[model samples]
Target chain A: MSTVRVENIKKTYEKGQVLALDDVSFEVKSGELFGLIGPDGAGKTSLFRILTTLLVPDAGRAEVAGLDVVKDLWKIRQIVGYMPGKFSLYQDLSIEENLNFFATVFNTTVAKNYHLIEEIYVQIEPFKHRLAGKLSGGMKQKLALCCALIHEPKVLFLDEPTTGVDPVSRKEFWDMLDRLKARGITIVVSTPYMDEASRCDRIALIQKGKILELDTLEQIIARHAQNLYAVDADNRYNLMNDLRKNTEIVSAFAFGEEQHVTLPPHFQDEYLSAFLKEKGHTGIKVRKIAPTIEDTFIKLMLENQ
Target chain B: MRNLVFLLQKEFRQIFRNPTILRMILIMPIMQLIVIPLAADYEIKHISISVVDQDHSTYSSKLVNKMTASGYFQLVEYTQSYAQATKTVGDGKTDLILTIPAHFERDLIKFNKAQLHLAADAVNGVRAGLGTAYAAQMIGDFNREIREEWMLLPKFNEMPQIEITSANWYNPHFDYHLFMVPGILAILVTMVGAFLTALNIVAEKEVGTIEQINVTPLKKHEFILGKLIPFWVLGMVSITLGMIVTFVIFRFLPVGSFFTIYAFSAVYMFGVLGIGLLISTFADTQQQATLFAFFCMMVFILLGGLYTPIESMPEWAQWLTRINPPAYFIKIIRAVYIKGSAFSDLIPEFLVMIAFAVGFNALAVFNYRKRSA
Candidate 1:
């Protein structure tokens, strides 16, 4: 059964002049970890806000725990936990105080649900008496998560929870989420980091307020129906320009230190490498490469255009 | 209701944990109660005078003696020339100049009356009025005494008779401290309750914790009530401490029902908290909230009759005071403390305060935004 369902969710700001979410629709299974992968302003935050019932969508229906988001917001609030994009825990309050406050807000106690947040809370428990404002970025992030999970919510919605956090802490946070998933909790998380998408059971690639594709990481990669190659030379910039200028190269874009190039179906790498050397290019390196989620996202965006 | 209790607990923890806020909540009221009353007195005393005694007679000396004996005027300098006396008054060294006309004892014997020129500085209207009245009363008594002494001839009973009787009500002693202490207590409660709560919420908005609460299971009504109720209670506690100090140190206590004073104060505090929350909703930063709350408090306290009597203000100002919750609260407190009025007499003020509280609270809740948009 679907734990959270959103259908044709459209949200606009400034009297519908700017569309934050346009015809977005998706679902999260009862126990699956779903990821909404996109850049900033791609409507991920808006979608999370609508599902969490903090905001009413301009058009569409969303449900959490089989209850309508608008009509049963109070019921939804009691079952679901939410952490916004920013570090929004009470700063003047101590870490323990913030935890107790959120727990009490839900008519529960930390002692009742301490096991749910124990892994994340233990790291910051030593300094629980310290004001949250004085904590480091990673500590604040952990405290925020603890507060969000103090009630053992059935479904958790995190909007870019790892933004601004150190890479090590980000990895640890994902590990915690994976453990939570094992406990049969539905997790719907949004992130701009492409690498984080691989950990999700399924991912939705969104851009410009539209969902381009939604599928498993391997499935999305399987849909890259093109011959792709990575090309490098002593002058990377010159190599990229030459590849983009060539009519044979259908699409050429830089990826990390190497440039990813897509060629016509009939084109062969042996012929292209020989042709490059004959054209006065030296020390050329060409190799077949696998498509990443980011590459698939870019290709989708390009195909849409 | 459970959420409200938790929120109130959080608020109390926040207030007590922050040393600065705690000090401001407790210390400021005490300072205003003790220091402000002493500093805000309007009663005039110890007016300096320079006497230009042209007569240089026992009669003139006796008149001066009577003026000094009144304890309102002090003989600062004795000038032989009128110019010197005028200069002393002009330079602010002396508040008045007493010019005794040059007259022989034969004049008083022949005329039965003498004229004394009194020149008083009138820049401070109230002090000048009091000083002139004091000098006149002293001179009049001296004249009566002289006439009585001259009545050895047994014909003084033929003169015209004049009688003056004065009665003061409410505060017969005219103690300014007694009048000001209650008003200052109201102002202190207002600042602690409204200004502090408004800034606290706006600060959360600025720092982003409001969004955290927004996503939680906390309802909007619960959140707002949770934030306000604690400060309201704190304001009442401050008022109680202020009243206790007023009784212990100043020997002043309310003559009416204590329950009525607290009830009115409680309702008025709600209005103040609502105003603060309204300000918080509109302001994006703690600084903006503080400044706006400060501005509103100034207007409310000024119109609340803390300094001037409400009846003495113009009709338009008096009408405006009707909407001011502090005005009603101050009136109710003063009426209870000073006049020993009962609850029935304060029914109208209590109703106005309740209306203000409900109205402002509704406005605050309505204006609060749930979404960032």
Candidate 2:
């Protein structure tokens, strides 16, 4: 069954000058870890706010756990957990106090559902007496998650929960989400990092307030995958500027030390090397590479444009 | 109800943990209650007078002596040149000039009356008016004494005289402290209640905590009341502290029952705090909230009739005071504290205060939406 059903949702701000969401629609099945993957200003936060009933859609409807986002807001509020993109916990309160406060606000007790957050809580429990403001970034995130989950909400909405977190903590956070999913909780998480898209069971790639692609990880890449190439040169910067100058190159984006690019169908690698050699380039090497989710995302973004 | 308990607990914990708020709630009232009353005393004294005594007679000297001995005026210039005295008045050195013409007490002995001239610098109208009145009173007393001595005493029943006796009621000594303490206390309670509740919710918005709270199932009134109740308790504690300071510094205690004051304050706080909540609902940031709160408080306090009597205000201003929440409370507090008025006697003010509380709070709760538009 669909736990969340969004139908052609449209939202705008500043007297309709800025369109935040346009005809956005999707569904999250029960116990599914659905991801909304997009860059900043992609309407991810706006969509989450609408589904969580914190905002009203300008011209569409949404539901959470079969409860209408507008008419049944009170019922939805009791069942859904929303951790906003910004750190919203009271900074002056202790970790334990913050957790207990949210629990009580939901008309439940922390002791009643202590096992739900126990895995994440035990890590932060050592510093439970410390003020939330005093904790490091990763610990603050964990405490926020614990507070959001204290009532064992059926649907959890986490907006960019891993944005500012370090790599190791980000991995640990995903592990915690995996465990929560095992307990049959539906989660809708949004992130700006394209690499994290694979961590979800399904993702809807959103851009400019519109969903570009929505599919399973393998299905999305298989349907739109192309022959991507990673090229290296003596100078990475010059290599990128040089590659963009060629009409044969579909797109070239700098990815760390190597520049990943898509070439025209049936284009020979030697022809590119020969073309660069004529432009005073030397020691150029190119090889075929598997397309990453980021590469697929870039291709979809280019196609939409 | 359970949700409200948690919300209240969180608000109180945050309030107590903030040292700045702690000091504001505890220290501000006592300090202002003690210092403002002492500096705001309105009984005018020490008027400087220049006596241009052209007639150096005994009566002229006696009148000047009586003026100085009255403790209201000082004999600054005793010059024969009226130009010099006029110059002193122009220079702001003297506040008044009394000219005893060259009668030399001859006119008083020969005729039944003598002429004397008194001129006051009417720059500061109140000071000049009062100084002139004091001088005229001393001269009148001297004239009466002269008539009693120089002329034969009138027959006991020859002149029919109607004597008027008057007594000061309420504050018998006209104690400025007693009159000002309760009024100032009313303002202090108002300021604390209004500003604190105004900033509380907005501060949560700034810190981004309201977003989380808004997503929860906590009802609108529960959240607002949670913000209010703690500050309401603090406001009452402030009034108690201010009263203690009033007694400690001035040895003045209210003649009315303390229960009446608390009952009135309880109702008064709801109205004042309701205004603060109303402002909070309209503002998005702490800066906006503080500015809105300051604007409302300035209007309420200025028109509150604490500094000026409502009857003396212009008709429009008096009309405005009728709607001012603090004005009603200030009048109620002063009446109860000084006039020993019981709560039953202040039914009209109580009714008005209840209206304000209900009207403002309803508007606030209605304006506050758990869902964004």
Chain A vs. true chain A, TM-score per model, equals 0.97, 0.98
Provide the DockQ value for model 2. 0.65
**B111-218: candidate 1 lDDT, tens digit per residue:** 876688888888877777788888888888887888878776786576666878776678888778878887888888888878888888887788778877876777
**Candidate 2 segments whose C-alpha is farther than 4 A from its true place:** B48-69, B74-165
Interface DockQ of each model? 0.49, 0.65
lDDT (CA) per prediction: 0.86, 0.89
lDDT of 1 by residue, A1-305 (tens): 99998899999999989989899888889999999999888999888888988789989899998999999987888888899888888777899999998998888999999999999988999999999989999898899889888988999999998999999999999999999999999999999999999999999999988999998989889987668888888877778777778887788899888888888889888866886776677889999877788778888989887
Give the TM-score (vs. native) of candidate 1. 0.80
- DockQ-derived CAPRI band for the predicted complex in model 1: acceptable
True-structure Cα RMSD, model 2: 3.4
Clashes of each: 0, 0
lDDT of 1 at B119: 87
Clash total of candidate 1: 0
Q: lDDT for model 1, please.
A: 0.86
Q: State the lDDT at B93 in candidate 2.
A: 96
The DockQ score of candidate 1 comes to 0.49
Per-candidate RMSD, Å = 5.5, 3.4
